[model samples]
Target: MDTPALIADDLVVLRGGRKTVDGASLTVAPGEIYALLGGNGAGKSTTLFAILGLIKRSSGVIQVAGHDPEVAPDAVRAAAAYLPENVALYDHLSALENIRYFLGLAGQTRTGAELDQAFDAVKLAPAARTRRVSGFSKGMRQKTAIALALLRQTPVLLLDEPTSGLDPAAARDFHDLLIDLRKRRVATLMVTHDLFGAADTADRIGVLQGGRIAQEWTAAAQGPRFDIQALHQSYAGPDAA
Candidate 1:
């Protein structure tokens, strides 16, 4: 069997001598979209940071593209494309220019036509490609960031609250972009508060509580079905009843 694109087995992270991420385990297979659902302080972002090797893992294993993040941080980074909540871009640069500049920083050089295609793949308007990102809407900016991810063509993708501020239509567009990535076999792990979006986009969903995955659901198992109410209840916790 092919190795999973991302995996965290019994992962733990300590902050101030306390375990913020406690024995959380999950996997994202190639072409899979896994949503890690949680409220604030649930250790969602910490787990992602650990996978990126941004923080020292107090214990357990983390692999990005089959390489340990701690032992081979460079390999893990090369294999993953991360889109944080607020994607940072040069305000003065046009969409095309931004992608070109960042790609060059990663030691990649692509022609103008190829860059245009990447923007197109992410559904960015051709007209907007020449406009400075400083004036772009949140959705437009996100598409630009995703366009860069397309150029990178990494095997693993990490997203944090990717749809936080978008309206319904833009959120839908973002979800569609992720589906396209899935077709290309990019394993995606997203931390989100968007329950409906998670149900709609993820092949599997894991609910995190107190830094551990307390519940998991698979679309295939649900099959043409999803109960947002149940998901909300799970998210609401035992006291919500």
Candidate 2:
């Protein structure tokens, strides 16, 4: 065992007087990329929120980097970087300025050149480096978010809908970035609707249905062939075998 980098044991969450997460348990070791799948309202996002301490979990223990978020929120957040579906940034600020601001908030200051270098890592265009974010596309914004996380150099990452709404080329680049992150030993947990992405990047894919893990699969070693359509069918059908 590599000593789990993230753990959620019997975690539960309630919303609108209903059970959303019912005794969910999960663990992720270092250097592993886990793809979390589920139907609508299956608690996938809830689980991530619980682990991040974004929402108050109703019950169970959640740990990241050996620290409970409730007991040590700063430490837990420091050990992990999260990228939501939409990154909140000042639309008028340049990419470099955005990086400096977040890094400074975390007490890590960056020079202009250093900030540009970080954006370059995610293949941001030089012109965009100094341009306002209001003009940047969704892909550019997502890249900026990733670059910020990369700057933090956290051990764990939780991504929700990372590739959603991106074009084919942009999505492919995003996938490549994630693969590179895995090589750098970042423990990853992604909740995505893109099954192809899961097959391409994840060492393991876990399906969460009705609040419980329904199945687990390994990627094919020789090729990029994953039957996501079939898996989706199986996932949607109540009679899946």
Candidate 3:
């Protein structure tokens, strides 16, 4: 059996005596895209933080590429790439420059040609490569961050609200980039409230409610993969009875 690229089994995280994430378990296999959906205070981003070792877990087994975050944080980090809702880049620096600088921080380097190729893969315009990101759009900044993730070459990716502010056209474009990553054998786990976007892009979808996986749906091998209306109904249902 192929080992999962990311794993969170019976995970629990507490903040000030309250469980932010309680017994949430999920996995993203190689080349798979898993979308986690939840409403406000659902602890979606908290889950990502635990996987990245940014926050300590109260209990549970969490692993990235076979390494435990608590035991080997460096290995876990090396095997995963994270993209938060806000893609932060130096406003005064160009896209290429920002990528180069961040890569340097990670003790890695890419030739100029390689950098351009990464940008191309993310659909970042050639014209915008040298322009300072101070004037870039949300979509543009996102593309640049994705390009950085591509250069990092991690097998697992964790995205938080990836399409939050994107327009319809831009969201579709971002979905295409994610599909491209899947082809490259990257395992992606994204948390978002965009039901339609998840229905469009995810190989599997899970609803998080009451700090656990309330339900899950997998893409069918034949016919329609998901029933959008049904999912919306389930998602729209009250978190508590």
Candidate 4:
């Protein structure tokens, strides 16, 4: 088997003495799109945060792009880009400005032409390129964030609730964008509540319930039998219940 691009072993998190993520363990290989699915309060966000070094893992080992965040944050972060459900962009900054700014933070220095191409690749509207994000819609903001990620050219992507509050049309577009990223061989970890999105986009799915993955759904044939319903029910294993 190919070596995993990301790995988590005995991932644990605590908030007010509650074990939110209890002993979650998994490995994600290169070019694989993995979805972390669960209902609210299931610790999906917590897991992503821990992996990104946003919230320290109380007692777990997580390797992102062959680097340990606890021991080497800069190296791990350099290989990954994070897009949370609610991206925090400067409302006063134009999309291009936002992309340019964050790219700099990632130690990236792209020329204007390169930056523009990144925006176009993510399908951000050229018409909205110069407009401040203050008035842009959620979808527009997300596209800007994606542009930043693309420009950074990270190997691993970590997203939390990526499709929340998006209209069907916008959400569909987002799904397509993710598919395109996979074609480019970027390993993706999507924390999503949208089961339909999970069924369509992810190569594999894991349900995070009770602090452990109840079961794993490996890649199925590409026909209509991706088994969306089976995945839904599989989340509720005897242990999960």
Q: Model 1: per-residue lDDT, tens digit, 116-197? A: 8888787889999999999999999999999999999899999999999999998998999899999999999999999989
Those runs of model 1 whose alpha carbons end farther than 4 Å from true positions after fitting are: 221-225, 238-241
Candidate 1 lDDT at 234 equals: 88
State the lDDT of candidate 2 residue by residue for 149-220, as single tens digits.
988889999999899899998889898888888888888999988877787778878788767677877667
Per-candidate Cα RMSD to the true structure, in Å, reads 1.5, 2.2, 1.9, 2.4
User: Whose TM-score is higher: candidate 2's or candidate 3's?
Assistant: 3
Write the residue-wise lDDT of candidate 4 on 1-241 in tens digits.
7688899999999987999999999888888899988878988989988888878878988999999888888888899899988999999999888877887777779888988887887778788999999998898888889888888888899998889999999899899999999888899999998888888899888888898787778776757636766765676543542
Please give each candidate's TM-score: 0.96, 0.92, 0.97, 0.93
Residue-level error in angstroms, candidate 2, position 146: 0.4
User: For residues 1-241, what per-residue lDDT tens digits would candidate 3 score against the true structure?
Assistant: 5689999999999977899999999999999999999989998989999999999999999989999999999999889999999999999999999999999988899988889899998889899999999999999999999999999999999999999899888899899999999999999999999988898889999999988999999998888879987898899984522
Query: lDDT order of candidates, best first?
Result: 3, 1, 4, 2
Pick out the ten consecutive residues of candidate 4 with the lowest summed lDDT: 232-241
CA deviation > 4 Å runs, candidate 4? 236-241
In candidate 3, which residue ranges exceed 4 Å CA deviation? Answer: 238-241
Q: Model 4 clash tally?
A: 0
Candidate 1 lDDT (Cα, 0 to 1)? 0.91
Clashes of 2: 0
**Ten contiguous residues minimizing lDDT sum, candidate 2:** 232-241
Worst 10 residues of 1 by lDDT: 220-229
Q: Is candidate 2 or 3 superior in lDDT?
A: 3
